[model samples]
Target: MIPIRSAGPADVPVILSLVRELAAFEREPDAVTATEAMLADALFATPPAAEALIAERDGEVAGFALFFHNFSTWTGRRGLYLEDLYVTPAARGAGVGTALLRHLAGIAVDRGCARFEWSVLDWNADAIAFYRAMGAVGMEEWTVQRVDGAALTRLAGR
Candidate 1:
């Protein structure tokens, strides 16, 4: 059985390593610019921007899930947004990912969240199938928009 627990400041290094591993798995190894100190600050600050859950199997880290809360006007309730979920390469087929997701789902229900959601890359067929198997539907009609870096600064008239 895999045990799931909340991550703390002491887990910053391990969390960052898993984050890098996830980036590499997603074919974006250089995308993770966050450092350990950044993670510690973000996750262990007075009011954390996010929370993380770590899964351990046989006393070894197997996977992790990073998430935060959001508001759902439609439901008039808060929602849980999963930012990232990753299982070690060796633990992919061993149910680590599913376990992590299930754990988060429990948290969502416990907190009275209107929903739990996350986005998966369009090219990640395996993840798509897995999420579908777990009863998650794709929001095909919704398009995601982003503003970042210089574009964000310019838009803000900075």
Candidate 2:
């Protein structure tokens, strides 16, 4: 059986390693630059920027879901954005993903979040179907935008 719980400092190394595995599965192995110390700072430091829930099976980290809360002024409500979710292939098909998602939903409900959202690559049909199966509606009307590197710096300094 998969055991789920909020991650603490002792789980940091496992979390970082699983993050690397997730990046590799996405075909972007070089993308994960988050160091263990950096994660400790951002995730466990005072005034935490985000929170994570981890899935473990037999004491091994099987998967994780990282998320943060967002505010919606127009709706006058808060939203929970699932930033990253990954279950090792060896751990898939064993209810890990479903458990993680359901756990997130419980938190959203407890916090009175208006919505729970996440983005999946268009090529990842399996995840899309899994999400749909879980009663998630496709947000086709929304377009995601981002700025990074120098662009982010310029925008922040403006």
Candidate 3:
């Protein structure tokens, strides 16, 4: 049985490890620039940038979901964007992933968020199916634009 609950500072190491694992799984391990210290400060410092939920099974940490509040421009209402979620291979099939998602949804509802959103890669069919089964609709018409690292530096320098 997996228990899901909010993460605290003590879980930062595990969370960062899981993030690296996920990046490696996506074949983009080199792209992960976040360090343990970065996660620690972002998750535990004053006015935190995000929050996390962890899944534990039989006293062992199994998975985690990290999220932060966002806003929809059109509706002008708050939203919850699940930045990362992962269940370790050893714990998959034990309801860890679903539990984390449902947990996040509860938070979203409690906070009156207009939406709970996350992006799964187009190749991740299993995840897409799971989300669809949970009544999540893909806004296929929308394209995601991002600026990171050098682009962010250049954009800000403009």
Root-mean-square deviation of every model? 0.8, 1.4, 1.2
By lDDT: ranked, best first: 1, 2, 3
Most accurate candidate by lDDT: 1
Candidate 3 residue-wise lDDT, 1-158, digit = tens: 46988898889889999999999877788877888899989988899999998899989999999999999998789999999999999998889988888889999999999999999899999989999988899999989999987999999995
**Maximum-TM-score candidate:** 1
Q: Candidate 1 at 2: error in angstroms?
A: 1.1
Per-residue lDDT over 1-158 for candidate 2, one digit per residue giving the tens place of the 0 to 100 score: 57899989988888899899989988999999899999888789889988989998778778999999998897799999999999988888989999999999999999999989999988899999999999999889998999988999999996
Give the worst 10-residue stretch by lDDT in candidate 1. 89-98
Runs in model 2 lying further than 4 Å from the true structure: none
Q: Which stretches of candidate 3 lie over 4 Å from their true place?
A: none
lDDT of each: 0.94, 0.91, 0.91
RMSD of 1: 0.8
Off-target runs (Cα >4 Å) in candidate 1 are none
lDDT of 1: 0.94
TM-score of each: 0.98, 0.94, 0.95
